[model samples]
Target: MPDAQKMFERITLPRDAGLPVSLCNVSKTYRTGFGLPVHALNLVSLRVPSGQALAITGPSGSGKSTLLHLVGAMDTPDEGSITVGELELARLQERERAAFRSQIGFVFQRFHLLPALTALDNVAAPLLPLKVGFDKQQRARELLAAVGLSGRERDLPSHLSGGEQQRVAIARALVNSPGLLFADEPTGDLDSRTGAKVMGALLELRSKRGLTLLIATHDAGLASRCDRVIELLDGQIVSDSEG
Candidate 1:
């Protein structure tokens, strides 16, 4: 683990004054089954400005997903820090981290929706923890409509197309109005046409809501659509360029 202060110096700060998300010298290492150490991330640093979208691209085992977990606070780094908004994630307690994570929406490659739950219920899952003033069901319905699933609110995952299910997942992700959205292989299971639709929904969300988007994927076409493309190799970011 490198010293955070020193690693901070190495990161080139973006021009944006208030980047919604940042990672400084973030590293995560694990022991392989063979007892050899594997470095999933090595002194990785990044800053995603507010309302910007960044696509993380790499070959398999290149630590793209690991970087997402770090930024999403699903896991802590072995070294360095990740900050979201004004919050320093490394300094938060476990409960606080959980709460903070609720403010971040995650779309998994597998959808991860409950088979028994309808699209509406699936989208409402995040609001269970908030207990806010609004009606969760009403909010979920609105989100589903926004994603073009207005008539399928009662449909279960089994009944929807891969694209539709993914849209439901996106609605679920945005139900909380999260400042950041983390998507992993968002269109991995769909055809090119369906994938384009999913990307369209994401792009619409970015432009309409100004939501910051980070997608971890191996798809070059998808990565090229984002505002910036970051390449990961051997658990390190080798290149980052504007798209």
Candidate 2:
């Protein structure tokens, strides 16, 4: 197996490549069991520039996750269009969408690590589906170290602290060298102090990699750290402001 340094050398992004996201009158709705219709997003539209961090802040049912899902290609909007870089998400075929999604990184509120796998293994798992040319294990190890988990590569999720576990998740997200990162309430599972550490690591990595970041959170403090913030209410954008 190649060493971490050698693996790191294989991870590269084009010097001018950065994904800018755009949404145009997007909407999503769900049908309830009782035959009621619930609007998750209603004609929402926004744009995020390349290499910039944007925060989505809203109340519990304000459709923040719905917006993230559409932008991340996890779900398609019921109406309008979503564009990430040059790809129109709603217009993509299954195969093309799968290919496009592989270029994005996602971190959730829960650290969805496998309890049976070591941190290194968890990070390397995502690369198994892709045709990456480098050693996934070494790349995972390097990502772990980059997130301040240099010596904890072998630690299981249960053995690490909350902050450390989140760090591991971040490393796993970055293992594929994604140009865009989507985080949905990434710090919601931790205490304030631990959350701060995780958020700091995320921001540092974004700066280092020039990644386009979109984070959905209720934390005002965390939102304040982003380059811009958009507030949603009742599935509609209520305010959009620069930080």
Candidate 3:
């Protein structure tokens, strides 16, 4: 198997930040060659308003990650519809989908920084293949400052702490100024203190940019930090309450 860091370095899949999202009776099933097919999501319906912060809580295989993937257009549902902002996902062609994805930012548990790049360069990687109006390094610096990594721009991934590296990943994800952000266990690898700081930065940016934020997490403390929380079980929503 390939090293996770090296794989990310090679593919460099840049993701985006916020859009009001809607899904209607969406279902996704994976058919393994062996026995019963696994149902990742089943008739799941949800609507997230623009600029809202929603946390999804569930045990493993409860479809939290699947929900995010479907909503983010990283994967498609086998049934029903998904709409983000003004666009319907299933209808978008390949090129259009790529363009749409560029406008959305995503953060994951793994930092995925290129081993060869400095912090500043890592944060600016997403912008290298696109045409943007802003200066990349300046944007990266501003984001690093926001995440409290001001003096660490020249440091490589190996030289930084886990928290700082994650922050760099966050900056890279947001380089396109996406309208929606999806975080899948973003703080799963950090200690409580570091995790809190990372979540704080994310919420601050979400509020500042008016981005809709969706976080999937096992930590109740982290889930409570959002404006609303939804619990999932067996690929279905079981509870949705205010944070």
Candidate 4:
């Protein structure tokens, strides 16, 4: 097998370079039934240093997904600011935000793989939209191998196990060589053993690529593996500590 480290080196930023994420007094509110305003996040603020692994934990209504969405640029905050590296996300124009998102990878709980596409095609799909000028297929193949999906590139999502499908999703997320990665309950669909294996692969990639990682999960075991953990309750931060 090709060395995973070498494969990562081809797509990673310099070892000394890592992106820092900062949120200052961020808040988001939603209008629900009866025109009532639901505060999804109330003055939430945090900082994740470069190359650090941070876990976000909370109960079902604690705004974990909302927080992840804001940080990942999938949604904008109604108040305060979120800055990744030197770019202020809230202030970016729509086109600029799209460009910025291209530099960040997101892994959702559902894996989000197209069932009809082979693993290789699924990983390469993002590149087509970005108009990236390189061999997308080669990069996709390398990422699949790096994620230990070698020889399974031709398999459809249905053919793979839950863990295998998640791995493929991870490979797809990394295809653009993002400087930061966001995962929301990446292991939620898998058994414990498989979850552990998937987490191991994620951390290994984070270390090798100098990529900042932020994960939102309810599993304490998974949260404990991160460098730090933040707990939320009722849309507010209740505690933050080292893992």
Clashes of each: 0, 0, 10, 0
Q: For candidate 2, write residues 165-226 as lDDT tens digits.
A: 88888998887788899999999999998988888888888888778889999999988998
- In model 1, the Cα lDDT at residue 228 comes to 93
Cα-based TM-score, every candidate = 0.90, 0.91, 0.90, 0.91
TM-score of 4: 0.91
For model 2, which pairs clash?
none
Q: Which lDDT tens digits does candidate 4 get at residues 178-226?
A: 8789999998888999998988888888988778999988889988998
lDDT of 2: 0.85
The number of the candidate with the highest TM-score is 2
lDDT of 3 at 218: 94
Q: Of the candidates shown, which would achieve the greatest lDDT relative to the real structure?
A: 4
Q: Kindly report which residue pairs in candidate 1 clash with one another.
A: none
Give the lDDT of residue 59 in candidate 4.
94
Tell how far residue 206 is off in model 4, in angstroms.
Answer: 0.4
Per-residue lDDT of 174 in model 4: 88
Candidate 3 stretches with Cα past 4 Å from truth are 1-18
